[model samples]
Target chain A: MNKKYNLAVVGTNFIVPRFIDAAERSGYFHLHSIVSRKTQSGLCFRSANGYDSDVVIHENIADMLNDDKVDVVYLASPNAIHFPQAAACIKAGKHVIVEKPMTSNTRELLSLIALAKANNVLLMDAMKSLLCPNFSILVDNLSRVGRIRQCTSTYSKISSRYQGYLDGNNPNTFNRMLSNGSVMDLGVYCIHPFVHLFGSPEQVHAYADLLDSGVDAAGIVILKYPQFHVNITHSKTCATTNSSEIQGEDGTIVIDNISTLTSLKFVDKKGEETEISAPQDPNSIFYIAQHLGETISSGLKESAVNTHALSTKVLTVLDEVRRQTGVRFPADDR
Target chain B: MNKKYNLAVVGTNFIVPRFIDAAERSGYFHLHSIVSRKTQSGLCFRSANGYDSDVVIHENIADMLNDDKVDVVYLASPNAIHFPQAAACIKAGKHVIVEKPMTSNTRELLSLIALAKANNVLLMDAMKSLLCPNFSILVDNLSRVGRIRQCTSTYSKISSRYQGYLDGNNPNTFNRMLSNGSVMDLGVYCIHPFVHLFGSPEQVHAYADLLDSGVDAAGIVILKYPQFHVNITHSKTCATTNSSEIQGEDGTIVIDNISTLTSLKFVDKKGEETEISAPQDPNSIFYIAQHLGETISSGLKESAVNTHALSTKVLTVLDEVRRQTGVRFPADDR
Candidate 1:
């Protein structure tokens, strides 16, 4: 029988609910604890989930990591705190699964990688999209389209929070000091597929229009490779068709959305079109959840799904773009 | 009666036919002479069009421009020859119309502009797409869609000649020394709209995968503006869907083809879609043809349609992309 793996859930806002629900469905995993800053909020969450009254709720992360009940640490802190918390967890010799925009800077990510190596533990950037089987199928079928000439991918969502900003309230997401912006939040989807398809870009250029709060409300990035080019657009202040197209010499592949990877259409040079659809797992987040379980159960140090090298490259590109556009966060100065 | 604008046609290639046809269609213009390096080709072209047989065909451009009958010169030379030829025409007090990839460099274009000012004659880059009615519609309606966050444009075509080159033929289009490649040939279309809309980028970072001949077979250029970003991709060694998307905060405008501006669709948030179909002009080439007539009739010394400043900016970007990617053209040495 396979060893059972348990996970300590971290952060309890926005995307965490989906993560928890997905973990529940994956038979290989068990949720051991939930941690958050506010004790009342953490207690409310634990009670709602029928967790024990004495469930570990750590206001201080260091205390949580030292607890014998916890086997792995997941960091879902704000963009600025991700680095310090992740680095601390790695130092504590605990496996870590951090949410996307993994670390604010590439240099910090490198340090964490070194620490993970020394501690003989696992560290993964939860770029969940790359782990999806549908994405794997798309990667396998890229050659079928022929030589890729150009690519355009957009992942844009209109933020209702902008209305608050306009009406005189600051949502931390649009605040530049927190490293909160459209590119960091939404463009990760755009960058993942390009980096996965083509290696690192030979050169990168960014054009970004900033919001009043000095954050990149929206932007476009161009990544040029040896045989072709990729164009990435992301915005929180705006909305888009939210589709991606890869144009090749012989045919073109169109995907409806960045996540889910549901609709795929292949159009040929002669203008004939073919549609291909496949059923996804009951929960779309199953891929990453399963990977975490297997890695922990087997006592493996790392995951092939999210490599340190790939994460570093993505961070490097992200940092370069921000530097070029003058998008400085409080963490950047530090 | 309108002023009769005398024009000289230079080169007898693919574009020359369209120039002559458009010139003939304009009642305000007269085809005074046609010049070519080979007397036989010049005479053949003239006779085919039933041009006045007594019209002189000169091998030397200086002598041809000295003739009182020539009020303007049309340059459709090979990519490498544009700078010197356009400069000579400007020096001779003749208005000039030059084809795309204006002068291979910003410095050359600036020199031509200086000569045109000294001689007091019109100098146009003949960027027909900027003058098209469809583009005008796009520019006018841009603000109605809300704040534009990103613009992604692609222009590509399947060149049989490139196929022949891959099969071991030395086509001039792929020749690095001639400043002939996809960015100059097709990517110009990609940049023109961006320049027309947002002005010049503060900084440009471009990367290209060079062909064997040291020309950029395909490339991506990112133009960074203060508010938004523009991503452009162009290729000649392959084919593409050849469409563009102008995305804003509330909705996105999809254009089927930038080259012809054929189809458009407006898609908003909540997945609601509206089809926007404007009637297509029978001749997509009319913009340049009509602009030439209007410029001549107005006795304008220079045209804002394809002005010298705009040409300089576009060439500056092209040169930068080439410089970064190590694409060297013969004209760079000059």
Candidate 2:
């Protein structure tokens, strides 16, 4: 029999409901609790989702972590508080899945990894791209393109909150204090695939257009591998069709919406295209939920797909990019 | 009546025949003379292209220029010799059209500009992209995409000469002494359109994958404008569909092939794509030939479309790219 673990979720953002629904539908987990700064919002989220009366709502993260019934906590709060919230969950001996830009920087991520091991709890970032079935297929079919020379991956869309920011409001997505910026919120989606597919580049150079709030509005990063180059362009101030291409010696692979792995096709030397086939889910978050659920069921310390090592390397690159772009968060010093 | 100028061509490469056909078809110029290192090749080129027997063939460049009937000289020689050949034409008091990467460096370009003035003749580089009818449409439609935040333009084709280079032969295209590299050849196509569209960028950064011959096999260049970023990725080592995009605050412009401007469309915030329509020619080179003939007939000393000032800015940026990539030619020193 497949054991369904009890899952607690933090925050009440759009992503939170999606995560909760995916987690329960994967048949490996159920919504066990909710944590939010506002008690009313947590209750509203649980009621709206029809999670029943047993789903506990905690206004305090510490009080939420004290619940032994919660086997794993998913952190989806603002970019700033992921570290402290995940650390409290880990110290309480519950497995934790922190959302992307896993923590403020490499320092906080490393600390969480250590604390998770000390408390004998699993730790993983919600890096769902790698867990998606299409990622493996994309990597497997890369040879069809011959010796790769370059990959251009991009994800850029104006945030719903951007208009407010332009109207002289300080949204958390553009707040320097919250460790929120384009590189963190959007660029990470572009970076992880390169790291997963090509490994760490020999050199990383980045140029960013910073908002007046001292956060990146948009940026271009050039990652120079020994044999090729990978360019990552991400923005919260602009939008694109977001198609990407991988150039190779004999052919090219065209990927539609790389962040989603929407559709992929390879054009050979003769310019004939071969459609790459792979299984895809409407909500990719479900794959990560299943992977984490399976990991917790097997008593594993971390997810194999979203490994600690991968997160560490990604965060290190993120730190280097921030250094190059001159974006430092108050959380980084913490 | 518009005067059809008498034109002479030096070298008998593939582009030479194409230029001859376009120049004549445009009804603005007729082949007047031919000069080549080998007399037979020049004679063969004229014969194969079906030029009249009166189209004079000269083994010596000096002999070709001495023909008073030859009003303008079109240089189609190896890149390294463009400087010397163009200078000789300008010194001989004849209008001249040199191919792209006008000279090895900015110094040579500036010198030729001054020399053309002193010699009282028209001087121009055959930069075809700006002359193409579609380019004007692209520039004019920029507002539909809103304020541009980024542009990724690439032109990479695995050259037929690459196999020879891999088979341990030094093709002039990969030869260091010939001022030949991917940037000077293929990358030039990607750079010119950006300079024409956005003017010059404030900063340039580049990375190259160099061949054993000490020339770039492939490269990525970052051009940082004050408000946006432009990325140019070009290679002779690899091939791609070579589609590109201009990302803007409200929309994106998708280009099928930037080097050719084969197709373009604007995707708005609602994701509705509007196909951008413009005049396109099967042989796009005809546009440049017609413009050059018209410029000479108008008694202009230089091209307004492919201005010397634009060429200067482009060459300056190219020099910076080479500096960053550590690609230098023996011709640059000369």
Best candidate according to DockQ: 2
> Residue B271 of model 1: what lDDT?
55
Tens digits of per-residue lDDT for model 1, B257-311 = 7766776777775557776746755565566767887887787877866777778
Shift of residue B16 alpha carbon in model 1, Å: 4.3
The fraction of correct interface contacts reproduced by each prediction comes to 0.58, 0.53
Report clash pairs, candidate 1. Answer: A209-B227, A209-B228, A238-B249, B122-B301
lDDT of 1 by residue, A1-334 (tens): 5554556777877666667667666666556667788878988887776766765777678777786666677677677787888888778777888887888888778888888899988898877877777787677667867877777787878777876776778887888777788888888778877887788888777767888888888887777776767878788877765368787777777776776677677777666777754667756777787787777777787787678888888888899889877788877777
Give TM per candidate.
0.81, 0.97
**B1-334 in candidate 2: lDDT tens per residue?**
5677899998898888889889988898888999988889878888888899999999988999888888999998888888888999988889999988889899999999999999989999897888887777788888987777778878888888988998998998899898999999989888888988878988898888898898998888888899888878889987766467888878888877776687888888778898895758777788889899888888899999899999999999999999988999997776
The global C-alpha lDDT for each of the candidates, from Candidate 1 onward, is: 0.77, 0.86
Each prediction's number of clashing residue pairs: 4, 0
| Interface RMSD for all numbered candidates | 2.8, 1.9
- Highest lDDT among the candidates is held by which one? 2
User: Candidate 2 has which clashing residue pairs, if any?
Assistant: none
Candidate 2's docking class is: medium
Report the TM-score of the second chain of model 2 against its true counterpart.
0.97
